[model samples]
Target: MDRLARRLGLRTDPHIFFWSAGLMVVFLVLLLSFQQPIGDAFGAGREWITTNLGWFFILGVTSWLVFLIWVATSRYGNLRLGKDGDRPAYSNLSWFAMLFAGGIGTVLMFWGVAEPISHFASPPFAGVEPYSVEASQDAMGISLYHLGLHTWAIFTLPGLAFGYFIYRYDLPMRVSSVFYPFLKEKIHGPIGKTIDVFAVLGTLFGVAVSLGLGTSQINAGLTALTGVPDAVWPKVLIITTLTAVATASIVAGLDKGVRRLSNLNILMAVGLMLFVLIAGDTVFLLRQLIESIGIYAGDIVPLSFWNDSMAQFTDEGGWGWQAGWTVFYWAWTVTWAPFMGVFLARISRGRTIRQFVGGVLVAPAAFTLVWFVVFGWSAMEIDGIGGSGGPISAAVADSVPLAMFAFFDQFPAATLVSGIAVVVVALFFATSSDSASLVVDMLCSGDGEAGPVRQRVFWGLSEGLLAASLIVLGGEAGLAALQEVITVIGLPIFLLVFAMMFALIVGLRRERVPKPVEAPARHQTAEPRPAQESPPRAGSQT
Candidate 1:
């Protein structure tokens, strides 16, 4: 415990800890106390935002994505995150694995098969028929857009800003540290404390929401495979089981626990994708992936700008769909920025600015595209196009949790693949819990001290309890309601992210460059002894 404390900076910043943890505790208490009113209020606020501020969500993510790409390709690209001679803390493969696992492993696993199918069944826009060829294309395209570089960019900028400022300027590993270039020493004042505290809230609520969603999906999977009753008890059981596993992983530390689990996640994900590909239509899935990339690239420009404003009057469902899915996704990813950034910054110490962007943003987005294409396209083919007349689409339409298993049932060894999926989901959430605890610990601790192992257990269990509470409170509907609440909490983070961007640019410009040394005057002593002739530029003087 002593060693851990020293590693995490060992000092307690009460303002940050109290504000962050206090806000969350108060929220949890109020939520449970006045569930109906709070849920209603959240629902109302969500509707208003979706109705009015959809454009902001759309433009914000797209602009950030463009901005990060510009940064990666600009003159600052070669800038090392650390000093010039430093090497990366983790190897490239391990780094990417951890990043993928921590950033969106749970999200992708939960939505990979479900999203595409859902979109196909119910087109978000008007004039599009469900389950048509065009709808299928739109489905994959929309799914790609949601999980693309845009989402990763939300995470990448903060990591870049935090990593650059923290390592280059020798600042603390806290969100406020990114403001050091602009705020200078004020980072230690109340303003800095507030920023760090909000970051903690953002991380806590973001992970808590994910845990809620994950428990629901896990329950769905369990009920489908093992005939477990899809009740609050089963969901709670799932949360408890996984939270215990996460506690063990958290105790094991990042390298031994998180890294190992992340590597296993990637391997399992690849295996699942391959199983679907080979078991279904190998050639078709490969073509779908390439074609999906092309479709996504071509449509992203207009799609990013598309706010579905026209559909507001013509179709009520249009705005609701955008709010429920795209806006919610953007908000979720935005909320995840601080946690993701702090976690990424820790492991990405030795990377150059360009490497960090490529690894953190581009690589994971590309991998997501492939994962979607494999599962999504295959599901569409098996159920919609190939004349298989499978129940996958119907199952998805009825319940999202059943989507993957329904797809798996189409192939041989249904039970085996489904079982693998359950394990993957569990482990992914465990990684999330571990990573969230570490990031939140950093925020509250105000540095990279390891802190106490008990804190990890506390956070892991807290997340589970919060998730279980939401489930018991409202079931899947409760999770959806919490999504809106989480988005509301995320608005502050969106502002912080933009501020961090400006600070990063300022800090990079102020970075010190090595000056070249001048060679000494040649043979000064010998030349002085020989001494002396005077010469004029145009004419000699006697």
Candidate 2:
């Protein structure tokens, strides 16, 4: 990235793309060539991963919210994320892209069905029966489980870390910045280099899983809607085409590419929900969603600490059940947090710590509660009580796009819905890629100006290539393993972010603030300097 940045006459720093792509290639090669050695090392430790790794997710998010609240109410509240006397580093347009792209748009794109059905088959709730009506509730409940506060809470820390360090402390906002104050002396040496390397390593593997999972489902949607075959050629072709679209957005940079994609995405998502709410069982969904949110309110604290699943997984059949949803989604989202956090930081300038935490971590969970209520509820209602048999279930699972396509096919607005779906997918895909490209550029160029076009093109192509490669290499199981690696990588990223937040909090408060003085006398009485004396200290910026 530094070389490319120099070559392009832009500011230079660590280019993220090379590191990201490098890890992915390395992971793939190990899985293919040295499978035994890799398994012996990584595959050998499932227990430590399930318990401790899971705790990191729980711990990291909880701590982030705590720190954000502390900072917001503390002296840091007056200090925003831009340079002294400069406008906020980003505009509302760019900010919205960085903010919404992670939660409201990219992650939620295909989850309207994929999650509930899988959960219906199995659930995290203690006493829920599998495949029963209650099971369906519990399944949708899990989606709400992950999607709500805790997940977004996971995002807030890194955003805080990045924003505070990059905009305020004159630090690089990269993942490594979080560790700065605590490890500056050591980090400057080989020890620090290792941490930076691991951070980049973890970042690539984590993002790869998200891109791969999301793109695969996107391929499924395209195949279902159009008549494309579910084969390698079609998947590859679609990814390549979509990558170009995302690349175009990246070329436009965050101001154009990323922001436009997010706006379109949020709009498409609203329309989709409206379709489900209006065309399907609106009354029932509203009732259930409301009830579920109430239930979630009561149970969230308990759920956060529910680590008793240790024995149940090995005892009951919940092992396979959990490895699919909670574990996978946690890993994917956890890994993606760093990427999303950096983007979130870039946009969250001029905003308070309170606004940043509330908007990113709180608002989206409220939105997900609606989807589970409306869309997830509608799916359950159609299957259980709406009098449809296996057909609706088959429709939802085998071809969600086709089912929706068929639903709109009955209406006079099939053309419009189809157009929206295509546009939505395109925008959602672009939202994911553009952000990833920016992070890649961040990793590569080290500077913040959307990296470089050629670097973005390379990452855009690599993302498509990785998605296609996973599909061709071993299909769903390969994708599954790839995703597990993402979750596993998240454990360390979580720790790294914790370190960053710790540094931010400590550094922000470490100064020996002079005792507050009374407002100066109306006139400058005695200390008037010769010609040009600056005013007395009022407040700190960094």
Give each model's whole-structure lDDT: 0.79, 0.61
State, as a TM-score between 0 and 1, how close model 1 is to the true structure. 0.90
RMSD of 2: 6.0
* Model 2, CA-based lDDT: 0.61
Native-vs-model 1 lDDT?
0.79
**lDDT tens digits, residue span 437-512, model 1:** 8778777765665567866666677777777767666655645676778778777788889888788767666643
CA RMSD, predictions in order: 10.0, 6.0
Q: Mark the regions of model 2 whose C-alpha exceeds 4 Å error after superposition.
A: 1-11, 14-25, 28-48, 51-56, 66-78, 83-94, 130-133, 185-193, 313-321, 385-419, 476-479, 511-542
Which lDDT value does model 2 have at 506?
A: 70
For model 2, residues 450-519, the per-residue Cα lDDT tens digits are: 6547767776777666656555554435454564456566666666766777687675665322232543
